[model samples]
Every structure is written in C-alpha cells, then in structure tokens.
Target: MQDRNVYTIQQLSAFSGLTVRTLRHYDDLGLLPARERNSSGHRLYSRSDLLRLQQIMFYRELDVPLSEIAEIVDDPDFSLTEALERHRKRIGAEISRLQKLIATIDTTLHTVNQETMSDRTNEELLYDGFSKEQIEEINAEVDLTYDPAIVAESRKRAKVMTKKEIEAFKIESSDILNGLIAAFRRGAAADSEETLKWIGRHVDTINRFYTPTPEIISGLGDLYVQDPRFTEYYDKHVDGLAAYVRKGMKAYAESMRT
Candidate 1:
C-alpha cells in the first residue's frame, strides 16, 4: 500500500469514474490541481484532490460550463469551504424535492399493490407527483428563457400538427434518443463524423416536430441548459451526455446548408 491518502492518477480515475484523459484535461484547464509527483513523475492525488474532484462534479451537475468552472476553481482566492457551503444548500433543496418524489412513488406503489386500485385514474395512480401548477411554472420558465422567434416557430409546428402526428413524431424522437445513448454507451467519439451523422438525425427529429432551423436546432441546446428535467433525461441515459450532444449538434449544424 502506498499511503493512507495518496493515490495515483489512474487510481483516482478508477475511483471517480473519470477518464485519465479527463483528469489531465482538468489539470491542463487548472480546474483540478495535482497533489504531488513521485520520483518517476507520475501525478498523485491526496485527500485534497479527492475533495477537489467532488467539487468539480458538483459544478458539473449544475452544468456550469467547464471553462467557467475552471476559472472559478483555479483562483487563489477560491475557497473549497465556500464551494462546499454552497453545495450543502443546493443539496438540501434537492433532498426536499426528492423526498416529495419518493412520497409520490410510495403512494403509487401502495395503490398498485391493491386489487381495488384498478379503478383509479392514471393521474391518481401516479399520485400527483407534480402539481399542474408546478408544470405551469416550468413552462413559464422555458417560455421566459427560450428565444421568442424560435418558440413561435416551434409552437407553430406543433399547432399545425394533429395529435396522432405528434405521437408518431415522438416515436421517431425516442428512437433517435436511444440511438444516441447506444452510441455513447459503445464509447464512440463524440466528434466523429459518424457521431455527427447521428446528431444530424437528432436535429432532423427536432425539425420535424419543432420546425427548427439548423441554428434554432442548435439553440434548442438550451433545453439541456435551462431545464433540470431535460438534464435528468440525459443523465439517466448517459454520463457526459449534455456536453457530447451539444458538441455534436454544433458540429452537425454548422455543416448544414439548409
């Protein structure tokens, strides 16, 4: 055993599920600092480095854009104490939300266990996981942040569509999402030409449903930005997703002539 707190970069990478390349990039970006180097010049991690990785992951959870996070985390005045304090508050908020979700799920499961529950409405069976008011509030946030012309265009496409058409379109979207997820799972390079083809298909799906121009299709990247719901969808399916999708979409969109 080397020591109680000291770890090699490869060890830390395995412990944290981060790639060695990503840790190197973080080091290059100055987001994560190395603790020490052994005689052979291998980077080693200390308890401090582990804590720093935690801080970086927290910032990533909120999608703070790694470049900006690098600046904030690297400043001499930057205090891990401050970052941790902020994390505690944010985590407290999430705990409260998760508790509510748990209650809804528990209630639904209880109902599902009962023979008499067959008559319950689907909404009731779902246990009112979110109030209609909450959905309205979310929609309000999206409306406020989404570009108006793009929103109008997206909304117009929806307005012109029949319910059956929308359902059919959603099937296409689901297929595209599953494909993107599978590609990521297979460890495909996010910037590969084949990956860009998948991204172009994704854009086509959005254009079919949302009337997105290549630019607007790219702008819909904001969905992953401004909405935790969207973020959760990606995170549930793939790690490092939102960034990969964003990079791929931008590459694909810029190549498009129409």
Candidate 2:
C-alpha cells in the first residue's frame, strides 16, 4: 500500500506547481533530494520534502538566488519558524510599496483624465507622487552633482513633456529598474553580457530626459551608491541593488569609452 505521507515526483510537482524538469534540477543541485524510491526506482518525496519546497519557493519569490537559498535552508541552526517571521516582514514591506505605487498610478490617472487643462505646471504634474521635501532633496542633489547649465537644460526638457508622457516615462523607467533588479537577484556577474544589456536599456531610458555620455553614465552609477536617497530607493527593491547597478553601469561606460 502506498504511504499517504509520501508522494512521487509527479505527485509532488502537481502539488507544488513546479515543473518536473525544475524538480529534477533541484534534485541535481541537492536542494530537495527525494527520500525514497519505489521498486522501479522512481523518486518519492516525504512530507518533510514538501515543507522544504515551500521554503525554497518562498525564498525564490523574494528573488533570492537558489544557491543562497540552499545554504540558508541547509544551515544546522535554521529555524522554519524564524524564517516564516522574516518572510512575513518582507512581504509586509512589499505590500506597503505596492500600495504606494498604486496611489501614484491613481494620481496619474486622475491627472490624465481631466477634461480641462490643469493649472499645475509640468514639473508639478510630473512629480505627483513625491513630497515637497523629497523633491527639494532631489533637486539639491542634482545641483550639487551637475553644472547649472546642464541642470537647466534637463529641467527645460522635462518641462516640455506632457503629463501622459511623464507617466509613460515613469512606467518605462520602473520596468527597466525591475529588469535590473531581477538580473542582480539571479547572481549574474556585474559585468556580464546580460547585465550590460540591462544597463544599455537604462542608459536609453535616461537619454529621454538628458543626453548621457559614457562619463555621465559612469557618474550616475557612482551617485546611485553614494547618495543616500538613491541607495535607499534601489535597495528597497533589492538589497545591494544600488551597488550591483553601479558595477554594471561602470562596466558599460568603460565598454563605451573603449
């Protein structure tokens, strides 16, 4: 008689929503080894394996590297209860971020749908989600970092953009940032071809606001890590993301110079 507590690889896949191939890959990586085999040598998973898989999936959802997940879950002192508590905290943070993003989208939609022209200046509409303090802080950083003429030129370009255009630009920027975060999470080398491709896309996105030479791109990368505001923004999405992006951008800038 088949044990109720044990599942075949196929059964486990169906239960976990992981593909057979993925489960096989996990097994090969020694991440989730099957505890028993049938007479025909088919893999069988115990209930404990299912719980381990739950941990793996949770870490994966948080964009943790599989190798890191393995080390974490395999540690002798690992406590599932503590891990669950941490996961809850991380998930709560994500929910708060999503709420803010939703609010930004709602504001943009309201601005876009107005039949009458808004009295708000283009800069006001474009920076809808930022508090006055945040805008001031960002402006101060820009003034500190760049020449006045360059700052004037960038603001001139920004002021000419419509609300819809600004919203679209924000969306595109978010998408590119998410792509870079994903690359960083996957354990890709900072200077790898895949990371460079994302960095190129990021440069293109920035070019819509101001012309960026390789030197400017490299400088922007440095600012991402050096500025507390920029570092907080990127690392909120993924820890160490600002540093990872800086490395990729620096490498891309070097390639461009060469």
Candidate 3:
C-alpha cells in the first residue's frame, strides 16, 4: 500500500504531472508552501499539500488567474465540492463558446468562397452566443460605422435564421477562410487577379447581406487595420489575411460611387 503522509518534491511532481519548476514557482508565489524538509534538507510535500495542488490545478483549468486561485483555494470557507461543481458548469460554458466560435469560422469561410449573398447582412453572423452586452461592445467597435438601416435588417435576418442554417453558414465560411490561408501560404499575392477576386467576393457578400451603403463598407475597410478585433477575426481564419481583406475591400469600395 502507498504511504499517504510525506512526499518528496519528485514524488509530488510525478503524481501531479506538474513540473518541479512549476511547483517551486507556486511555492514562491505562496500558493503552496513546502510542508516540511527531509533530514538532508530537501523539500517534502504532504497529503494535504498534494490535495491542495490538485485544487489549484482545477481552478487553472477554468482560466482563473493564479493569484485569484491561490486566494480561493487557501480560503478556509472555500468548499472543494462547491469548487468542483463550479468548474463543471464553467467547463460547459467554455465548450459552448468553442462550439460557437468554430461555427463562426465555418460561416466566414463559406461566405468568402461563395463570392455572393443577399443584402440582408451577415456581418454579425459570428456574434452568436455572446452575451447581449458583449454583442453590443463588439458591434460598437466594428459594426457601428455601418448603415443603421442595414444593421437593423441584418439583425432581423439573424433572428429569423434557424440554428441549423446558422451552423451550416458558419462551416461554409470557415472552409473559405482556410482555403484563403492556404493560398496565402503558397505566395499568392493579395492583389493578384485570383486573390483579389476572392477578396472582392467577400466585400460583395457583406454589402449584399448588410445592405451597407457604399460609404459604410468603405469606412469598415479603413477601420479593418486600425481595429484589433477586426484584424484578429480575419487573422484567425488565415495569417495576414486581415490586411489583405482590408486592402481588397478598400479597392472594391473605392470602385463604387460612395
């Protein structure tokens, strides 16, 4: 039978699969103090210490900051069972977020590939599942410059779409973005005939879906590079794709009589 009392740092590291350096750092951070030292002066962990480390790791999985987690796990009133329940619920939320994000990527890729869509507005297609406040913040950053009429219509259209329709649209967009990234990797020039064609399609789709005035699309093009959120959204689909899309949109919009 295994002993349940004292454990050398190595034994604790093995059991927890945590690096010795990490444990030492945690000790330095006062998240976990060495329970005792052996006769030769090496650090030793106790059953209590190991259990505490497990609690810390559990919080980390939920993206809780280390400092906050230390305070939480070390609190006498903090219930381990309650913590586990919270963790389970938080995990479910994270999974839901990931699922929505994947769908958004897919829809973006699809729209990029098709090169055409109606003027109902698909700009906020990726905004599903976000809290209302978060959605407002996102729109304020990117969609605020859009035509109010187009924005309202887009919102209405989004509300009417079935869940399956949204999911299908997301996957389609993801495919287009992945393809663009691949082409970009192969040295396709952003303004090259083929590449510009894809970018042009993207602009057209947004205009068609959002019914954004030419000026609205042009304004968005200008903001693409200046706004990190827009840049990151495009970049996530493909490296350096954001700047290229911005350029393409600018060129297409400039061609229009805004």
Candidate 4:
C-alpha cells in the first residue's frame, strides 16, 4: 500500500542524490525525520520532506553541521534570504583563497620547469606571494615563543616539499581549522568527542611539520592563546576558536599522559 505522493528512502535517495544511509542518519539525528512510516516500517517522505531535504543539502554543502542545520531550518526567525546572502560571502572568500593557492602552485610549477630552478633561492621557490620580509615576520612570530633553531628546522623541512605537497599541507591545515570551527559552532565541550576529533587532526598536522610529544603539544596549545598572531588566526574563524583550540589541545595532551 505505497502512497503515490509519498517516497520511500530509496526513492528519495535516487531523487535527491543522497545515499539512503545518509538520509537515515539525518532521521536518526532528528535533522530530517521521515514524513511517515509504512506498514513494513519503511521510512517515507512527502513533498514537504523533499523541500526540507533540499534545504538540508544546501546547508551541508556549506559545511554546516547537521545539528546547526536543524536549528536554522526549524527556527521561525530563520530567514532563507539571509542565509543565502551569508553563504554568498563565505563561499566567495573561500574561492578567493583557493584562487590564490592555485596561482602559487602555478608559479612553483613554472619555477620547477625553468632551467634557473637550481639558481632560485629557497624563498623564491617556496613562499610564493610572501616577500622575504613577510616570511621573516611569520618566523619572528613563531620564534617569540619557541626556539629560533627549532622554528628554522621546521621551515627547512617545509622548504624541501614540492608544489603539490605544499598545497596538500595547506589543505590539511585548513581542514583542521574548519573542523574546530564546526565543533565550536556545535557547542562541543573542551574534551568532548567532537572536539577531540579536531584535536586529533591538529596533532596529525603538527606531526607533519615536526614530531609532537605530549609536552610539545601542550606548549603549542599555550602558544595558541598567548601569541597574538596565533590567537588572531584561530579567533578570526570564530569569536573564541583560539581558546577552544587551546583547551582541546591541552586536554588531548593530558589524555596522552594518562
């Protein structure tokens, strides 16, 4: 007795391009519950469900967490026009960042292809778009808290990477930052599972640049808040992201000790 206007999970998945498992997960999260259930206990969706699913997909594409999406969609005060406007600005900024990264890659590739590749200095080959002075400023910021020799060693390691490796490293760093932002928006605790996941990613990113013992990790956490450069970097993503990252990193370090 399948209703003509109603759709089972499979039908919705086919129409929506979302996997059935994903649709079910949304139902489990109460973010997009089914409109009805059949006699066989199959989940069914209606026209309203289709429209809500479309909205869910739109927010999901923006990297909004399902929990946040639920609130935004369900809130009476939530304005679709405003949400789209906000997404427009954010997506535009992301596009600009990626475009710059692509240009950097192109420059690196051109340098590598030229016979003068061997003659180009490390600064020219590695830190595209950043002048020597800008690079010095960044290194000085790190050296303020850490040993200059250690920072130099880290830079030396990064300088040896090819253009693609550099891009991947940048992407990895962004992913960790975005993960923390997501956790923060969800109101995750300092040591909550969600926050811990981002902390794991942060640790892995640290490992890429340098070996990070628990002590080193904890020290880096302190630097996040104590260093204005890092504080600004993380806080720019969200109001208190730097503080949240510090807490999560410290908690992870403590767990490693136990």
Candidate 5:
C-alpha cells in the first residue's frame, strides 16, 4: 500500500506542472531527490519534496541558475520564511512597475482618442515612464559624459523621428534586449557568438541615435554598470542584466578592435 503522506512522481508532476522528465533530472542532480521508492522501484515524493519544488520554481522564475538554486536550497541554514519574504518584495516591485506601464498606456490612449489632447509632444511621450526630473538628470549626465555636439545630434535625431519610426525603434530595442536576456539565462559566456550577435544588434540600435566607435561602445558598457539609473533599468528586467550587458559589450568592443 502506498504511503498516504507521499506522492508518486506522476502525481507530483501533475500537481507542479513540471514534466516527469524534469523531475527525473532534478532527482539525478540531487536538487529534489525523491524520499524513497515503492516496491516496484517507482519514486515517491514526500510533502517536503513539494515544498522544495516550489522554492526551486520561484528561483527559476527569477532567472537563478539551477546549480545555484541547488546550492542555495541545500544550504544547512536555508530559511524558507526569509526566501518567501524576499520573493514577496520582488513581486511587489514588479507589480508597481506594471502599474506604471499601465498608466503610461492609458495616457497614450487618451491622447490618441482626441478626447483629451495632451500638450506634451510625441518625443516627450516616448519617455512616459520617467518623470521630468529623472529625464533632466539623465540628460545632464549624458551631457557631462559625451561631447556636447554628439549629445545634441542624438537629441536632434530622436526629435525628428516620426511616431511610427519611434515605435519601431522601441520594438527593435526591446527585441535585442530580450535576445540578450535569453542568452544570459542560457549560461552563454559574454564573448560567446550568441551573446555577441545580440550585442552587434545593440550597436546598430545605437547608430540610429549617433555613430559609436569601439571606444564609445566600451565606454557605454562601463556607464551601464557605473550609473545607478542605467543599472536599475536593466537589472529590473533580469537580475544581473546590466553586468551581463557590460561584459558582453566589452567583449564585442574588443572583437571590433582586433
């Protein structure tokens, strides 16, 4: 007779939405080892295993590597309560971000409908999420970092672009970012061809604003990490994303130099 307190592998899979093969892989990695086996050698998972699986899934959703997840969950002093608290905080931040985006969409829709015409220009609408103060801060930093002519030219180029062109530009930038995130999640090295390909696309995106030399590209990578605003913007999408982008950009710049 099966233990009432334990579940078979199939039962666990159906409950967790994970494949049987994935469960087997986790067992093989000793990440979520089965409590025991039945008389026929089928794996049986206890309630403890279910709780551990939940932790694994949460970490995975946060882009944590499976190996690191194992080390973390298997740590002698690992605290489920603490981990849950951290997850709650991160989820709250994500919800706030989404709410801001929703507000932006609503504003844009209202302007488009002509029921409430906005005094703000289309170029200003491009930066919907950022406040006027934040935009000024970012512009001030850019002015200090780059040549005045270059900064002016970039702004002029952006101001002259049509609304459709601006939307297309944003879509392309988003696609490149998503590609880079996917590569980072897959454990691709900074200098790997897959990573560099995305970085190359990023360079093309930058060219739409202003031409960038290898030195400029590498310098921009440094800025991404050094500037808190840029770092927060990227890392909000994926933990460690800004650092990963910096490494990839540096590698790409080095390849261009050679």
Candidate 6:
C-alpha cells in the first residue's frame, strides 16, 4: 500500500514547483526538514511539510529575507493571518506607486507627441533637453567665436534641418572627434588618409550648419587649438585632442587648395 500523507522529494518538487536541490538545501538549513526516509534512504515529506512549503513560498512572494522568514516561521507565536495582512498592505502601497508611475509616463508621452505635432523648429526640438543655462552658454559660445552675421546665419540654417538630420549631424560630429583622438593615440600622422577621412567628416559637419570655405576651415582649425573653451572641449576627450584635430583640419584645408 502507498504511504499516506507522504511525498517523495521529486513528488514534492512537482507539486510545489520547487527543485529537489532547493528542497534538500531547505532541509539542510532546518527550514523544511523531511518527516522520514524511505527504504531507499530518499527524503519523504508529510502533509505538514507541504503546508510549510506553501508558507515559505508566500513569504518569498512578499520579499521576506530567507533568514528572517525562517526565524518568523519557526517562532511559536507566529500568526499566518497577521503576516498575510501585513503583506497585503505592503502590496497595496507598491501597486499605488506603480500606478502613479504609469500615469506619469502616459502624461510625458502625450506632452512629447503634442509638442512634436505642433511643428516646433529643429533648433527648439534639438535643444529641448538642455537647461536654460546650457542653452545660454551655447548661444554665447557661437556669438563669441563666430561673427555676429555668421552666428545669425547659422541659427537660420539650423532651423531648416529635420530632427533626423540634426541627430545624424550630432552623431557624425562625435564620431569624427572620437576618430581623431583614436588616430592620435595610434601615432598616425595628421595628414594620413584615415586621419583626413575624419577631418573630412568634421568639415562636412560644419558645412551642414554653415557653408565653410577652405579659408574658414583653416581659420577654425587655429581657433580649435587657441580658444580655451574649444581646447577644453576636445582635450577633455584626449590629452592633446584639440591640437591633433587642428593639425588634421589644416592638412585637409591645404589639400582643398590643390
């Protein structure tokens, strides 16, 4: 006859959705000790053991630390009803937090879509993420470095670029600067084919916002090395990046002459 109120380790695993190894670990920890060992010396669990496994899973669902759960469950005065009520309250708070988060996400998405549909200029859309101080700094940088007429003209041109084009321009700009730094690290000559390729990308980026002549490109190269702000911008990425890129752009400008 089959043993009453008993389950083998495998049987308990299939019923409890827990691995035999985990059950064995729980047994070793005195968390879920087996009721008996059968003829083959395999663990056998009683009905009471199955109830304890249910309580363990419930505690786990509430994120109770295993050690704390063990202590609480083993305590003589432990009340399952009290634990369930506490878990319910905590779960309610978590649900409220998640609901608020979802509402916030929905509101932000609606605002972004509305702003996009309102046809804000590319410059507005592009600088949407920047703070007022950062936007002022960028405008100051452009005005300080370029002629007033050129600065005004560049802003007009920037308004025409689509969001995708603006994003591509930013990505290409970063890629060129990073490529120049990498080339410098490898001891590549500023006029080398690969280095010139990066310089070409840099000029293309400039030409997108404002059409730059060879003279303009050459002059800008000097400014990149001389201007502390520009130098800091490039040198932040690599020790001598501003000088390296200045040299590379000068080579490219000379090549344009021929």
Q: Judging by lDDT against the true structure, name the best candidate.
A: 5
Error of 1 at 219 (Å): 4.3
Off by over 4 Å in 4: 1-5, 85-150, 160-211, 218-258
Task: Tell me the alpha-carbon RMSD of every candidate.
Answer: 6.3, 7.2, 12.6, 8.7, 6.3, 17.5
**Candidate 4 CA-lDDT value:** 0.81
lDDT, candidate 6, 165-202, per-residue tens: 98988888878877888899899998999999999988
Which residue pairs of candidate 6 clash?
none
Ranking by TM-score: 1, 5, 2, 4, 6, 3
Task: State the lDDT of candidate 2 residue by residue for 1-258, as single tens digits.
Answer: 888999999999999988897898899999999997899999999998999999998997775667999999999999999999999998987787667667767767776787434566732554545556767887798788887877888889889999999998889888888888888978999999989988998898778767888889999999998887678788767658999999999999999988
Clashing pairs in 2: none
Q: State how far residue 74 of model 3 sits from its true place (Å).
A: 2.4
Those runs of model 1 whose alpha carbons end farther than 4 Å from true positions after fitting are 1-4, 75-82, 108-137, 141-196, 207-258
lDDT of 4 by residue, 46-117 (tens): 987887888887786654556888998999997777877887897887687667768888877777787346
TM-score for each candidate, following the candidate numbering: 0.61, 0.51, 0.46, 0.51, 0.54, 0.46
Error of 3 at 93 (Å): 0.6
Candidate 2 Cα errors over 4 Å, as ranges: 8-11, 18-22, 36-43, 61-67, 89-160, 163-202, 216-252
Please state the error at residue 51 of candidate 2 in Å.
Answer: 1.1
Q: What's the distance in Å from true for residue 101, model 4?
A: 4.5
Clashing pairs in 4: none
lDDT of 3 by residue, 115-168 (tens): 654555777775655668776787686455655777688778788889887787
- Prediction 2 TM-score vs. true: 0.51
Lowest lDDT sum, 10 consecutive residues, model 2, at 122-131
